[model samples]
Structure formats: structure tokens, C-alpha cells
Target: MRRPRPIAPAAGQESVWDYPRPPRVEPVTERVTIRLGGDLIADTRRAVRVLETSHPPVYYLPIADFVRGALVEADGASFCEFKGAARYFDVRNGGTVRRGAAWNYPNPTPGFEALTDRIAVYAASMDECTVGDEIATPQPGGFYGGWVTSSVVGPFKGDPGSLGW
Candidate 1:
């Protein structure tokens, strides 16, 4: 697949095209929050953001940051070439439950060990997800957990016709 041309980022913004292929996992101090059905699922000043070429950032909050009993382990697992095996969870918010809405790598690959026990939720499954003060837009596919915020520009991977990107 041909790489799409990256949009030029404005001051203080990042272009997804500039991210790396193997992905980089790093700490982000911005407060991240996730809410669903009027119930708070998570709120944290600490999160790990994974940056990969063609994709928006996917934020992973510590499992401890989530509300008690909010994540119920689900069956089936998938492997990420960079992150290793992932386990899914059914996210519960009050009376609402979104199946396989969250996942984690309990044992991440060598360079991505920071992801162990961290939970990454699909923004589309949440009533709201925010990075700092900015509300997040879910990446345009059900399979990816990336969230698009104004600070990042993208001809992102999940959009239609980007399947081979």
C-alpha cells in the first residue's frame, strides 16, 4: 500500500505519518478519563501512549486506575506483532456493558514491557473519553483502539481504503 500524504501539523500538533513503524510506548502526564453510561470507568494523570505509523495514539491507563469491577475478563485473545498476546475485557458501566471494549497485554513484548497490565479501551465504546481537556474521536474502525484528538493530525490507518496501510 502506498503511504498517504501526511497533513502538515500546525504549531504544537503532531502528524501521524511521522510516527514510527515498530511503535513507541511512552508516558503521558496529561489526565486521561473514560466515562460510560454516566459512570466513570477511569481517570488518571498517568497513561502510556503508543504511537505507530499511520495510526492515532492509543492510550493505555493502568488497570488500577479503572473503577472497581468495571472490567470483566472475557474469552479469546489476539496477538500483536509488536505487543504480543492481548486479553479482552467486557467493560461495565452501571447497567451497560460493552463486550470486548477493552484489552491489555498482560505480558508485552520486550521493548513494550510498560504495557503489562495496562488497559486500552476502544473510545467508540465509551460515552466519553478525553485526553487532557480535549474530547477524543475514535479511530474509524472497530478493531483499532486509537483515539484522535485535535493535537494530532492524521490520514489515519483505519479510514476507508486504508486497510492495506
Candidate 2:
């Protein structure tokens, strides 16, 4: 692994800082399982089967896989062009609640309506979660689900940033 270094500006000359990150888009579709409070929170009962000719599929899991009654319904919502509108939830543990930390498509578009009852939440707030056999630790710091191994013009921490120069 290569370490990042900071460069100082040369005297009286314009200096620019650029971090050249290779545009990575791995076509990943492996089974994963997540655990919270010692109970499996989510599992891929089926592979994330999507095609090169179609939009990707994110198969969320039912609440059964998680610790019983650990999630509280939140007031957050979002819209997707290909997956319709989504609802959100807050994860509760020991009187601490992570606000609006997860979201899921309730009534998705016709192309992805199969995830109507499934939920996809942030993998950071949980006590623990897994993707495949890898038990993912809390992300460095972000709100979006980092479980999906794809990129969309990052530095993406907040809302999707500018795409045009």
C-alpha cells in the first residue's frame, strides 16, 4: 500500500494538490451476512443478481435476521430514479439511537419493486455487520452504505457532489 504525502507550494509559483485515485468499479456480487448484538442482522439469501444490460440489484433483508426490536422507524426518505422512493430507520442500542442511519426502497420502480419490503441500512452504526465472510468495522466516517463495492465520482461523504468540471 502507498502512503499519501502532502506537498508544500514552491516559492512564487502556482501549486496544485491532486490526489489521483484510480477509478474503481468492481463488479461484485457475493453473498454477505451482517450481525448486530451477536445476532445476524442481514444475510444474502440470494446473490445480488443483476446484468450488464440492466441496473444493479440491491437485495435487502427482512428484519427477522436482526436482533429483535432493535430498529426504530425514522422520518427520513429518499427518491431513486430506478428504484422509486425509500424509507428510513434508526438503530437503537443501549438507549443510544443513531438517527436516520439507514434507508430502503419500500415501493420501488417496476424494474426493482422486488425489494419492497427489504431494508438496507448504514453498516457503520451497528455493533457489528458483515459483507460476505468479512466482518466490516465502522467506516472511517460516512453515512451512505459502504457495503456496495462501487464508486460514483467521490470524494463522496455527503450528498453526491458535482460531476461536471
Best by TM-score: 1
State the local distance difference test value for candidate 2. Answer: 0.49
Per-residue lDDT for 1-165 in model 2, tens only? 222232343553211123122211222355657555555555665423222111122235655554566677889688755567888888665565678866677677666654656666666666665545555543224643644233111232232331221
Q: TM-score per candidate, in order?
A: 0.98, 0.57
Query: lDDT of all predictions, in order shown?
Result: 0.93, 0.49
> Which 10-residue window in model 1 sums to the lowest lDDT?
37-46
Clashing pairs for model 1 are none
Candidate 2 has its poorest 10 consecutive residues by lDDT at 49-58
Per-residue CA lDDT of model 1 for 38-76, tens digit only, reads: 977899988999999989999999999999999999987
